[model samples]
Target: MQTSKSTTRIISISFFTLALLGCQSAYYGALEKVGIHKRDVMVSRVESANETQLEAKQQFQTALQKFKSVRQFNGGNLENIYETLNDEYETSAALADKINSRINDIESVSDALFEEWEKELSEYTSESLKQKSAQQLTKTKSQYRRLIRAMKNAETSMKPVLNVFKDQVLFLKHNLNAQAIASLKGELNNIESNVATLIKQMNKSIDEANQFIKTMSQ
Candidate 1:
């Protein structure tokens, strides 16, 4: 009877040990499944982030292209207009300088950002990227707007100066007497002074606008 009792106790202990091991195995399996699920979620998030970056990059490219096209058109028109005007007014030189300055400013920003953007785009594969590409794009567009404004102001200021020069030249051409010629020369000098002042103001405005654009781009 003692032998029977001892054998029964052994059997009960073995069954309890097996049951405990089964519970541990099930717990570990459940933990592994949870870990795999978390990994999948993380991977999905990373993919989404990459997609967002790509989309932002495309938008930036489009904006930049548009800016370039408009800039070229404005620059060409300005050149043609300046070339048609008489050189005596001294307006073309100042206008050309302003236009060139603006073109340089625009090119500097677009070229630098374009290179940086290409580099950043290649490395962007996650959603929590360090680079804020969209903000950069918006800033670039704002810079372009400032450049356009500066060009327009320069053009507008030049018109009045050209008109005054034209009127004075026409007057001198018609009134050829010595006294009339002397008086017309004096009048032309005064018109020239006014033109100089306008050019100075236009330069200041262009400088301020360019500086503002540079600040925004940075």
Candidate 2:
């Protein structure tokens, strides 16, 4: 079977950096011995993070829609409505948590890869080649910095949005009456606005991720 162009390129990079990872943790050592490398893992994590952000964007929209439904609640099984809203909030919370973990995993692999890259730069015998490698490392790092910052900016909004969601769910659980839902009626605009802003941030982060991937590949 033919290896993907990108996978082959990552494998070729691993061939060079494998030595730089000397006596590293068993986790990395074992993976390196096979076909996977730090760069490969970093790329994988980035893709996972991108997928998560997209999922989160959708979930936020979904949750907002569920919240909007509260304004239209006209004498039904109040318990059922509360349960549905609660489920949406719970799912949104879980997605937010997953996004956080993915970002952390990306950062962990990123540091490892960059450290190995820096060390490998010095191993070049020719000054011209060493300088080129150093320049590439610097450029890649700059690009990565932008990508990580965008991701973090998006994460910053997560908690506030989640807090809003949690508060609504808790309020609904405590008081399943019209008054509790009436309070939610005014929040639809604010909730919609916040989710819209979050989705925009996520969109930017996804763009940055794609750019970073291209920078690394180059």
Candidate 3:
């Protein structure tokens, strides 16, 4: 009877040890699976974020190019006026305002959080320009054509400008400002010459656009 009791105790201990080992194996397997799942989730999230950022960057770059083209045109228009009547300061101010407004639009659109700002900017420009007499519309259109011509000229002269812009982008990427406002005065003068030519072309286009609107209204 004593021998039977001792054998029974040994069997119970063996069974408990096997059961504990089985539970530990299962726990470790579950932890490994959880770790793998977590890793996959993190990878997916990182890929998604990278894609979003890349797309945003591409869009911003395209938009910036278009904006620069427009600016070149506007500068040409201002240049014509400045050349005809040396009102450098006034022209500079106007161009500065225009550039700032465009930059704001670009920045707002580039950032996902500032999308609403882009919408407001569009609304503001549309509304502000909506109320115009036929003569004013005509003049605006003429001005737009002039601006376009200026842009074309600026584009032609843009080998150096392009280089500068590329350098500026690199600097901006590193959170640096490439040129000071005072320094930009000279650059603006050079830019103005190109812009003046574009402005003439743009003015004509604007006139045509306005005329089309008028016709549609009729």
Deviation from truth (RMSD, Å), model 3 = 26.7
- Highest-scoring model, TM-score: 2
The CA lDDT of each predicted structure is 0.47, 0.85, 0.39
Residue 86, model 1, lDDT: 29
What TM-score does structure 2 among the candidates reach?
0.86
Least well predicted 10-residue stretch by lDDT in candidate 2: 19-28
Which digits, one per residue and each the tens of the lDDT, describe model 2 over residues 1-218? 98999999999899867754454556676899998999888888898999898888898888888889887778888788889888998999998889889988888888888988898987889999999889888887888889999999899877778888888788978998888788778777878878888888889999999888776665
lDDT of 3: 0.39
Tens-digit per-residue lDDT, 114-135, candidate 1: 5555566567676456356656
Task: Tell me the deviation in Å of residue 25 in model 3.
Answer: 63
lDDT, residue 46, model 2: 93
Q: Name the regions of candidate 3 deviating beyond 4 angstroms.
A: 1-186
Candidate 2: which stretches are off by over 4 Å?
A: 1-24
Which prediction has the highest lDDT against the true structure?
A: 2
lDDT of 3 by residue, 99-157 (tens): 33433332222232123223444454455454443344455345434533443332233
Residue 42 of model 2 has an lDDT of 85
